[model samples]
Target: MTTQYGTWRKSRLSEANGACVEVARSLRGTIGLRDSKAADSGPILELTRREWTMFLRSIRAADKIG
Candidate 1:
């Protein structure tokens, strides 16, 4: 859970006020997500590559319908 991540980036679709979430890709094929406002202290969400792919697909599907 405390693995060092690569470059952290926010989605281009993030809110203008900077209340956004950031994602990082680790070398081990895992993804890490954290609150942009608490990069240093906030807890990270770690997900395997497969899980991340599913999560993204679900979001895209939701966007298309909702």
Candidate 2:
């Protein structure tokens, strides 16, 4: 889906030491993720709502395990 990113937000995960990804909500049901270091490099990944949910679940599960 060709979506525009207007409300893109920088991740809280960003460190003063610098390694982070920025994210933006795109049109449709897609999530946009880009390298905070090189947004000009373009979005690194585009995920569907379901994919995003599953990914988040996996992260949560891993966090619990850790």
Best model per lDDT: 1
lDDT of each: 0.92, 0.78
- Consecutive 10-residue window with the lowest summed lDDT within model 2: 1-10
- Candidate 2 has an lDDT of 0.78
Model 1, CA-based lDDT: 0.92
List where candidate 2 sits over 4 angstroms from the true fold.
Answer: none
lDDT of 1 by residue, 1-66 (tens): 459899999988889998899999988879998889998999999999999999999999999999
Tens-digit per-residue lDDT, 5-61, candidate 2 = 667788776888768778777767588888778877654688888888998899889
| Model 1: residue 46 alpha-carbon error in angstroms | 0.4
**16 Cα displacement, candidate 1 (Å):** 0.9
In candidate 1, what residue range of length 10 has the lowest lDDT sum? 1-10
